[model samples]
Target chain A: MTTTLRTRQRFAKAGVLTGLVIGGLFAALPVLWMLSTSLKSNGEVFQNPPQLITESFSFDAYAEILGNGAQLRFFLNSYIVAFAVTVLTLLVAILAGYAFSRFTFPGQKTINAVIVSVQAVPPITLVIPYFGLVVALGLYNTYPGLILTHMVFTLPYAIIMITAYLNTLPKELDESVKVDGGTSWTALWRILVPISVPGLIAVGVYTFMISWNEYLFALTLTRTDDMRTVPIGIQLLMGQHSYEWNQMMAMSILGSIPVLVLFLLFQRRFIGGLTAGAVKA
Target chain B: MTSTTAPDTTAPTQEPVTPDRPRTTLTRRLSPFGYLSPTIVLIVVLMVIPIVMVISYSFRDNVIVQENSVFAGLANYTTVLTDPNFLAALKNTAIFITVSTVAHLILGLAFAMMLNTQLLGGVTKAIFRIVYILPWLFTIAVIAVIWRLLLDPSGVVNYVLQTLGLLQEGVNWLSDPGKALWAVTFVNIWSGYPFFMISLLAGLQGIPNDLYEAAAVDGANPVQRFLNVTLPQLRPVIISMAVLDLIWTSQQFALIWMLTGGGPLNVTEVLSTFTYKQAFSEYEFATASAAAVIVLLLTMVLAFFYVRLQKER
Candidate 1:
């Protein structure tokens, strides 16, 4: 019986290992393919029985993409918009999260409810109205327009995450600051913000990713090549006559690097933030 | 001695300073608003106001080019509801959501279970987790493009399949009307399942081993232990994740737009893409807004349940 049990356990372990390996490959295959395709020349991309790894590896696609000033502009635009959105979101979210976590005030429940409901509203629903609004305000094709629109999604997310993080902290810290005759501002800026650096960083990274990956608003709001973000730029690469598959793949890989780096650097905190935001909320 | 006695005498005087407490209480009552004002103002301008405007636009006969709004009451809604394209989009969205959500949940649970078994070393497991979530981290545009290349008629998928003798010739996955919707649904599942995986893994980790041990002592097998112990523990997480996934997958636009553009005769025309086409492609703002309002109402109902779920937890 002991031997049988050991055999069954070993079989189960092997099954699990097999499943993990398969799942990992399934997850990584498309990305690996993208890398492979990006390194291939155009002719190789279209070759019969497409090569997983081309014999003649070339950086021509990357070079072509980097050589294009418009592509670089898209990258710059994305960086600016993402950075601005992250800062704006973090500032608003920290203040609002601190309030929600610490204070019991009039209309608090209503505001909280509004925030929650707003998050549930699908962003595409507002695209038309926002288009009209932005055009009317003459903010179309502008960075501020995209930044403000991106905040509609990011602010609520950041606020909720920061609030959840703050909820885990003791209230005594604020009270102690109060006892020290320090104002609420001092408590937040001095006591809470310093301690909540990890949470703040998580929210910042989340906001940056959202803005960087945003497409619909970027597509609708920005008209000029200079204002278009990376995603839009990539879409434009697929013109009617010629689909620059290699260069598009190169740009896609380039666009993903910031997010990948952020995830790799803050893997634990980022995952914790995501799981905490989802599971708890 | 005098100093101690003086403070003792002063303590009685300090007790009468309760009059200031009400004023402080008044500030306390208003301060949350002060902190929340920025968020409130931004949401009002960006989200709340736009939502209200969209709803109003749905009631008017508005065109993007014309910029003239004449109240048409429910005419726009009627038009959208009766349109064949709109009906098709609604049906397609339902099918997509049902299939994608189920696929993600099942596959995600399987992946989570495998990961939870600890069959691999710590480093290997960590690498697997990262690999699984890489798709989720990738931008939808990038994901769409990568998948487009893979699913193209002459793409690697067909090449590999043909090499393995699974197909006699390359199949047009994206351009074929019959397969386009399912193709995009597959992509959605690929990128989306990791969300469920991570959440379920977290849920699984939270389950105590003692429960499983107790079930084993009760002569329960592995499947029985899972059904009896794990399912009940994971119920809340599953429900919440499923609900959120429903909203998200329903609103998905970029992937479909990039991969197929609701193409091959609008086989994958979801409500989001439908609305986009009406507004931008056709310049029919009122009709598009009406469709969007319908989508909003559907998601709002789910959101109501989601809120209740959160409160229950």
Candidate 2:
């Protein structure tokens, strides 16, 4: 009876472990394949029973995009736009968030409701209007134009997230700062700003990911190859006559590297930010 | 209206918190506005204005029959419903939503259960979480392209099957009308389940293991234990994710657009992508907007029920 109990316990542990490891590795298969294909030579990309490791790994695909294609320009455009939007959104959301958390005023409830309701509105509804606005403002194909449009989605997200975080802070902190010689602006900048670094970092990374991954606005608004973002630029590699799978995969892997790195560096905060939706009433 | 006198000529006012003087009226009303000014300005210029424009454009004839602006109340909407493409796209979108949501629920629960096991060490567990999460981080366009390569007639799946003598001929997975919808769905499930897995896993972690042990001692087998113990506990997380997944899948476009573009006789044209093509490609803005408005209404209704059910829980 004792031996049977011990064996059952051992089997249960082993069974569970095997299931997890196998399941996890299978889930990882596509991404692993992507990385592998990104390294393979053009000739080897579609080879039957795709090789896990190529005989001669080549940088030719990477070189093709970097050396010839306007991929670098696209990367730069994406970087500039993502950073600009992130900085602007953080500054604005932090202020709005602070006010929403700390203040009581007429229309406060209405404003909060509006912000939450706006999350349901489809972005496709606004594409045409944004297109017209960009054309009219003479900002078509410009980085600022794209950045401004990207904020349509990111700004509300920032406001909601930052406000939620700020709610956890004590009201006494604000009163205490007021009790000091500091003004509201002084307290906000000197005290509140310094303390909200983690929240800000989380919101900043979230906003950056949205901007970086945005495709429709980037694809439609920017016509020139030089003005393309990474998604649009990588997509253009698939041409009218023939698709360049190797180079396309290479560029995609490059495009994905920054986001992957960002997620790795801030996994906990990033996941927390995503799960923020789960908590809303 | 000359009721109150303006406070005596700029006397250096003592601190209000000193309990000596009354608060200034301007400071009270304008302070919140000062904090919210930037957000309001941005919302008006970017969101509100654009939404208004879409509404107006939807009522115009400039999209379908004419290039210049002309008022055609409900004309675009009328034309959209009559169009063959919109109807087909709508069907495809519905199927995608139904298929993907169910797939995510099942796959996610399985993943969460597997990860909830105790034998895995902290490091190996973390690695597994990251691995599962990597696909969800990718743009839909990239996922579409990568899967396009993999699902081609001579792509990886067929190659493996053929090598193992499992099939006589390679299947044209993407080109066939019958298979294209599932093809897109298969990729969506691959890219989607991670988010669900993470959320469900988080919920699973909070469940005490003693319940499972107690059930086991009661002579419950693994299947019975799961049904008796796991399902009841995971109900809230499952329901919430289901609602979110429903809304999200309804709006998903990039993957379908890139993969099939509502093609092979419009087998997979979901709502969002369909609206995009109709408004932009077909230049039938009115009908497209009407279709979008329908989708919006449906989603909002679903969301209302979801919220109510959640509150009840």
Candidate 3:
């Protein structure tokens, strides 16, 4: 009996280890190969036996991407657009979240429902009309066009998350200011916003990530190399270079750095918040 | 006013009228709308108006490009619904989303379970967790690029498979009509599963230790315990994730766009690509608008169920 139990324990351990290794490889090997290829010379990309690490590994691809004015412009546009989207989303969402959490507004449920359902509106649905509107308004191929449209995507999630976060904090935190003859607006800035920094951080990080990674709008709204975000820039690079494999890999890595760094910094908060809808119940 | 369904503990149902201060009551009354104004305006211009415009556009002929657009009634819808390519896109989208969601759920649950094992150290699990989430970290564009390289005819993936006797020759993954849909779907699964894994990992941790202990005392083996306890405990999260995944996976365009361009005789063409081609490539905005509206309505039906499910819980 003891021998059987011991054997079962051994098998379980082996099973777990095997599963972990295979899963780790599945998730990591392609990413690893991308990094390896970025380091390799473009000519070596299709060598009969692909090596994860090449002796010819150097920073040529990275240098090429960083040194180019057009490529660097993609990074700049991404930062400008994503940063604008994050700040604006946070401000708008915070105020809306405040209202949802604090007051019993007349159309609160309806408005909230509208915001929630807004997420279900596929981007493809909006792109056509947006093309008409943006062109009509002469905002086509501009930052304002991209920024405004991306907010439609970012704001709903941010509002829901911030509202959920604020709901966790007792109303008394803000109400105390109101009792002291201060307005709710002042109380929000002074008390609620300050205390809600962590939640706001999580929301801001997510907003930035969404805007940073956004493709469809950025692709449609912008018409120039200087205006294109990194994702679109990567696609352009694929077309322009055709088969400059190392350069393409390098661009992808560079493009991914901001969100990757942000994820690494706040994985726990971001993941916890994202899956809260699933897990909180 | 129906704060009954809010589910947040600290959210009070209504604002208490502090009778002492008229100013406070006034501020409370007016400020909610004031705070909400920006959101309202943005949502109106950006979401509501655009949706209205799209619906209206769907009824017209040559709306965007032509100056004298005509009211075509159901003509645009008929054109879209009758188009064989649109029908192909609809079928492909269903398969793509269903396969992707199921694969995501399975892979997510397995990884979550493995990572949640009691025998492993937290540090070890954390490293593996990072590895597991690596794919989800990259943009869909980067994912598209990386996979394209890997699935290249003479690429490392083929090299490994051929050497392992899995395939006799390098398969042209993206360009091949038979394999294009599955190749793109596989990439979709790869980039998508980490989110489900994260959610499921959190769900797994939330399952109580005492429940498992009780099951063990009741002579339940691991599999039996998992079936009776773990699965039941995780049902809510699983359903929620499944519905959410279905909604998202169906809407996936960027990955399919960047990877295959819905090409090789449109084998990988999904609704989003079909609509995009109609508007941008083919310049048939009215038909694209009809297709887009169909996609929207399909998403809403799924979302309606998701919201209802959440309310039920």
Best candidate according to lDDT: 3
**Ranking of all predicted structures according to TM-score, beginning with the best and ending with the worst:** 3, 1, 2
lDDT of 2 by residue, A179-219 (tens): 66545555566777788888889889888988998888897
- Where in model 2 is the C-alpha error above 4 Å? B1-22, B63-68, B164-166, B208-225, B309-313
Docking class of 1: medium
Clashing pairs in 1: none
Alpha carbon lDDT of each predicted model: 0.88, 0.78, 0.90
Candidate 2 lDDT tens digits, B73-137: 88877777787777887777778888899999998888877777776678877877787787888
Each candidate: RMSD: 5.0, 4.3, 3.8
How well does candidate 1 match the true structure in TM-score terms? 0.95
Query: Which ten residues in a row are the worst by lDDT in model 1 chain A?
Result: A174-183
lDDT digits (tens) for residues B68-176 of candidate 1:
6798999999999999999999999999999999999999998888878855678878878898887898999999999988998888899889989999999999999
**All candidates: DockQ:** 0.56, 0.50, 0.60
Q: Report the lDDT of model 1 for residue B120.
A: 67
Q: Tell me what TM-score chain B of candidate 3 gets against the true chain B.
A: 0.94
